[model samples]
Target: MKLDARSAARILRDPGALRVILLHGDDTGLVRERARTAALAVAPDLDDPFRVAVLDRDAPERLEEEVFALSLTGGRRVVWVRDATDAMTAPLKHCLGQASDTLVIIEAPGLTARSRLRTLVEGHAEAAAIACYPEEGRALEASIRQMLAAEEIRIDPDALSWFAGLLGPDRAATRGEVEKLALYAGRGGQLSLDDVRACIGDAAGVSLEDAAFAATAGDRAAADTAIERALAEGTSPIAIARSLLSHLHRLRRARLAMDSGQSRTDAMRALRPPVFFKRTEAFGQALSLWTADRLMDAAEQTQSLELDCKQTGAPDLTLCRRHIARLAGTAMMLRRDR
Candidate 1:
C-alpha cells in the first residue's frame, strides 16, 4: 500500500474499492490536493452533506460513524478527515477493520514515516497509504508547464526555468502563483522573463537558485550577492542547502549522461527541468569542470551543510555562506586546471 508517484496517481483515481486512503507527508499542499482528489473520486459533490462528510478532529469517534453511514442520495459516500494526527490512528484502525464501501480519505500532512497511522494503513490489504511530498526537478517543471498549458498560456523556456525555481515546495502556493501569472498573461499571451518578474517575482526561491548556480559557475561575487539577498529575504539556511543539493544532484545527472557517451548538447537537452537558457554556456563549462565524482562530493558536502544547519545554536547563515564560497573557489580552481 506504500505508494510512489505513478502508483499513487492510479490509486487516487481508482482506489480499487479501498475502504480507507491515507495521504501523509511534509508537503501539506500536496497532501491536501491529493486528499481532495480522492474525495472527489467517490463523491463528486462535496457540498452534499449526505454523500460527503467531513470528520471533525475534536471528535475522532465520529470517523467510524461517518464511514458506516449510508447515503440517502444513493451513491458512494466519502468521509474527509483533515489535519489528522496520530490520535486518530486507533479510530482509523477500527474503521478499516470493518466492512464498508465508504471511502475514507485522511489528510495527515507532516506525518513521520513510522507513524502508527501510516504503518497500520500501509500494512492493511483493504487500505492504502500515499506519501505526498513536494515535487522537484523534472516533476516540478512538468507540473508548471501543465498548469500553464491548462490556462492556455505559454512561457519562454528560460522564463519557465526561472519561474519553476520561484514556484514551490508547496503545491498550494505554486498553484496560487501560477493562477496569478496566468491571469497576468491572459488567454493567448506568452510569458517572458519580464512577465515572470512582474508577477510573483518577489519570491526568494530564485535567489537561492541563483546562489547555487553562481557558486558552481565560479561567479563568487554573484554567488555572494545572491546568498545575501536570499538570506535577507528570510530564506531558511536549510532551504538554501536543499537548493544547493538540488543543483549538485542535477549536475551529477548531467555528468552521468555524458559519461554514457551522449554528446554535451544532447546531455544538456536531456537534463531534467532543462538548464535555464541563459545559463547554458556556464552549465556546459561546469559540466567540463565537474566530474561525476566531484558532483557526488559536492552533494555530500551540501548534505552535511543541511545537517549542520539543523543543529542547535549553529551559525547556519555563516556556515551556508562559507560553503558557497568554498564551492566557488573549487569551481574556479577546476576551471583554471581544465
Candidate 2:
C-alpha cells in the first residue's frame, strides 16, 4: 500500500500490521527520521541486542537469512536496512514473500515508478511504500506547529513564517532548529519575531548563507571567513555544498528573469523568501557575475562536490573549501571581464 504524509504516522503506531515498509524519497533526513520512529516503536530500547538489527552497505549476501532468523530475546525484532538500493531487491523480495514476526524497514533514496524494488514492495499485499519528500506549503507550517506544540511552546504567526523560511528541505535540520528554539523559549513560553531572529540569526545556517552570498559575489575573504566559521561550528561539507547549490539555483532563476526583460532589482525583489534587505546588494552583485549558463555550471559542480563529500575516504571539508574558493575566483574573473 502507498502511504501519504498524513497516513505515515499510522505505521509508527502499529508497524506490525505491515510485514515490510519501504521509506524512500529525496528527503533522506525524513526517510531516516521516520525509519528511526518505526524502529523505536518496535524496539523501545534501541541498544537492545536482540530486538534491533541494523544493516548497512556491508550487509551479507543473503539478507533474507538475517531477516528470517529468530530473535535472541524472543520478541518482535526490527530488521532495518539503510541505504537500500535496487541491488538488494532480490533478498528484499524473498523476505517479503515469507511470513515472520520481524518488522523489516528499508530506507532508500527516491525511486521511480519503474524501480524494480519499489514495484515489488508496492505490489505486495503485506508491504507498504511511504514516500518522504520534503514538506512545503501548509504541510511545512503544520510540521513546524506540531514540533513546537510538542514542547508546549507557541510562536507568533509572523515568527513562524520567518522561521519556516529559514529552514531547508531537510527534516532533521528543521527539527534541530525547532528544538533549539524550544529550549530557548522553555515550556509554555511564547516565541516572538525578535526571539526567532536572535536565536537563528547566530546559527550556522546564517553563516552558511553568508558564505554562499560571499562566494557568489566574489568576495573571497568574506566567503572564506564565513565558511570557516560554519565548519568550526560542526557543519558538514555536504550541507554547505547543498546550500551553495540552492543559492546557485535561485541566482539562475533571477538571472533568467532578467533575461526575460525584468530589471535585476525587480527580479531579486520578486524572489520567494525575498532576499534579505541586508544581502540585497550582495545578491545583485552575484547576479552581475553569474549569468544563467554560468550559474547552471556552478550548480553542476556543487552537486559533484556534494557527491564527493559523501564518498568514503573523501576529504570533505577541504574539498568544500576548495570548491567555494574556485567559485569565488570565477566570480572575480567574471567581474573583471565585465
lDDT for each residue of candidate 1 in 1-338, tens digit (9 for 90 to 100):
77788888888988777888888877888888888888888878889999998975677889888889989989999999988888899988888777889988889885787788888888998888888777876798888888899878999977777677655477887787888889999987899877887786577887887888888989899999999999898777877887888788888898899999998999999875677677788778788889999999999999999899878799998999999999999999998987
Residue by residue across 183-263, what tens digits does model 2's lDDT show?
999999899877887888888878888999999999999999999998998777867877788789889999999999999
Report lDDT (CA) for all predictions: 0.85, 0.85
Off by over 4 Å in 1: 56-58, 72-74, 192-194, 209-238, 245-300, 307-338
Which portions of model 2 show Cα errors greater than 4 Å?
Answer: 60-62, 110-112, 207-338
Count of backbone clashes, every candidate in sequence: 1, 0
For model 1, where is the 10-residue window of minimal lDDT? Answer: 161-170
TM-scores of the models, in the given order? 0.71, 0.65
Question: Worst ten-residue run, lDDT, model 2?
Answer: 57-66
